[model samples]
Target: MPSAEAPAAAAMDGEQRLHPWSWLFVLLQQLRQFVLPLVALLVFGGGGGREAQWQALAAAIAMVVLVAVSLLQFFTYRYRVGADGVTIRSGWLQRNLREIPFNRIHNVTLHQSLLHRVFGVAEVRLESAGGNKPEAQMRVLGLAAAQALEDVIRHGGSDRAGRTPDAAEPADVPLLALDTADVLRLGFISNRGMIVVAVAFSALWQIFPERVASRWVEQHAQQLLGYATSMHLGVLSTVAAVGSLITFGLLLTRVLSMLLALTQFHGFRLHEQPQRLTVERGLLARLRTSVSRRRIQSWTLQEGWLQRCLRRRNLRIDTAVAETGNRSDARALKELAPIATPDACDALIQHLLPHAQWPMPAWSPLSASMRWRLLLPTVLVLLVLSVPAWLQAGPWGLCIWLWLPWAIYGAWQQTRRAGYAVDTALVAVRGGWWARYWRFAEIDKLQALRLSHSPLDRRCGTASLWLDTAGASNMQPPLRIRFMPEVQAQALYRQLSAALAARRLRW
Candidate 1:
């Protein structure tokens, strides 16, 4: 077998070799220039009896013309690699030149489809730091060549060691690399995709009647019925079995869909460089993403039931700076690495913030009064459910009563999961129960800081501190550190305020 380093070396040598069909690929991408408007014209033109025939003929011609132009362009485009940077020069009528410096390059991702794999060619994506768009992608490179190019960009190309801009690499950095097992663990732990599929299923069911949908449902009902009957039995066995089977079938379908979606990142790996961290993964479409330590504004750790059982966690590092150039062109940069163990996550955090403090002073828990205050939502829900039950005069009243215990339990769990810790330099907020998350932010990143007390909170001797950060509105519990004893909340607010007030404080 070829050594791992062979791929990197081969890529460097292959960069100068251009694929004959590269230009055709470029043209295919730009074929929309003519085909789209032509499509519009054909659809709305010829308003008489000949309209249908004309539209059909026009559509066929348009498709052929588009394919022909795309093929032409794909064959013509080519690129070359040099000592300083990679250069791409293409375009038939309006030639273009793009040179990307090795030092500025942040990530090099390789994507291979079945077709590309057969041809031994892969798409190489180049992402640069400190750029508005951050990424430039091109196809036609051999697979080995693509991986080699990635290695050069990641390790800083051989010629770039002493002469490259920003050549000074940070020392003593910790890099975490995920194995195949970790990828599988992450696949099972992720439920976001499952949740999405479930919601979509629910929406479709609501929009269409069950009778109309039952045909498809019934077709697969036997498989579900078998699974349910194997696991459960009861007095109303047949009816209960049917209902349970349907529910399990829906859940099983969602889980399978989620697993399929996660397979995209099946072979994930994290490479920690001296100055940055790089994540590379994909099943069909590979992606390489890197983030500089200096640019990471905040870090969040999340764990759900499966993750907790597996002792794994997901890490999300948020950067204040946006890859704006790519945004205008509608490109997405990779973010979020799932299923890192707690120790691995902690190490990554420490690597990003070497000198920062750890496990800051745990804030005092919420007062007993505050715990009672958390029950208000459950009380309101119970009352709402009771009203309809009382009017119906049926077993519905008992059904409402059955839900109260679960509601109270959920409230208690939420209260237990909420807490905060503050140190001179950082603040950590913990939230969620089944899906627990820990968010860490430096004191300096606060856009706004406040100590707030609701009328009920004040009476209960509890308060909450809201710390807002730029570009973090998407975060859950956007306002962190909710529901604490008033004194503790006030003290934390004062400490954070003082840190912000002092110009000497650094993140």
Candidate 2:
């Protein structure tokens, strides 16, 4: 039998079709993308039993067509990695061939779905600069084959340090590995549950037939009110009931969040080479992505109220080029450390970027004027709305006043969290109350810096600072330090300029 490395080298030079098992992957991919439309066609097709029968028949035909198409795609798609670069030939009707040169090839990502994992194959994606999509994607290949191809494309060899990937003596070292506890923290730290909820609600809305909108909402509201009224609830009882429901909803949402976290971050591991960081994660769909450490544009350290209470933080990395040149790829590549204790984060950052500070020192507050700027408007609006509410609902209207304090408290907390710091090598900013984040960009990656005061800020003699970089993490809002003392903003801007001028630009 040929040795593992030999086959890898040969595979790199030779054109090949996707692994046979890819048909299943292709089919699943199609079904997942179009399942909603198919569902809608059946649910709202509106022909009663006859229509249902026709819809079923149509769905069956569609499935057959999809299966056949997947088979054709698997057969037609061919890829090769060579000294020149990577080339792909796909499409059944009009041949669509793509060739990406090695230098132009931005990155190679390896992902494995549950189905692919079962078959011992992984997906390989090749990305190029300046696009929202990958240049080429191989839905299924043997895990070894994927790594081997990546090796040839990246290192110009079929093995690492003269050792085949299957060999045990590769030079790459493990940087970090999340244990069960750390993974659990990720579930709590993740705010993706809201996004999931929004998507689920969107699907549900699509599933609901159109004409039922007004009647359905009214009917459900009446039923809920009737049930609540039937209970003859007093203020305390109503409060308790509502509180219980709210708690349950929150718990359910958290549980959903936890599930997503587990599915996405299972068995997460990080490894480092001299020039790149490689991350491998997931249970259902495993993914391995590598990025050059130097390409990182910025770092974000985030802490929500829950994460803060738990003493945990999330670290995200922003890179110049999108990993696979798409949103999904961005999600997979940006998470530097999903959730870790502060100590672990410190270790990770020190190891990852030695010169960059994690929890910075000598932070300058955004200025106290921000407090009144945030609070005054809210107070005025509350007062404006409260009088009419009081007129209509009497005592119930006065109850709205209770929210004023909560709003003020939130605004105050934001002001407290707002700050900025500049060091010789980094420019950092802090904000966000419920979902607090600290973002710092390397002076080397600094693209542009601007300082502007809003009309409100002008009256208060405060300005907002915005810094631009090659790329910023989605989880981290754009670099905007709002409501800082105008002079401080200008000072930071100048400091950043000097620092940037002195350093070799990374981008």
Off by over 4 Å in 2: 1-7, 48-72, 91-97, 103-107, 154-170, 189-198, 210-235, 322-327, 376-408, 473-475
Worst 10 residues of 2 by lDDT: 1-10
lDDT of 1 by residue, 1-507 (tens): 011423344345433644555544445445645554554455445576787788778777877876776565555555666667777766677877788777656454555655565666666777654455544677566666666666566555663334453455445233666666676566555555566677878755654556756867886788877876787677698777668878897667656645664555666666666566766566665555555554455678888887888888878765544445332222223345566778877876676677677555475455555557777767777878788888887765757677767767776887777777777567788877767888888876666787888887877787878886654555564647877888877887887887788844322
In order, candidate lDDTs are 0.63, 0.76
Candidate 2's residue-wise lDDT over 150-173, tens digit each? Answer: 766666343422445555535777
Q: What TM-score would every model get versus the actual structure?
A: 0.67, 0.83
Q: Which candidate is the best by TM-score?
A: 2
- Candidate 2 at residue 448, lDDT? 80
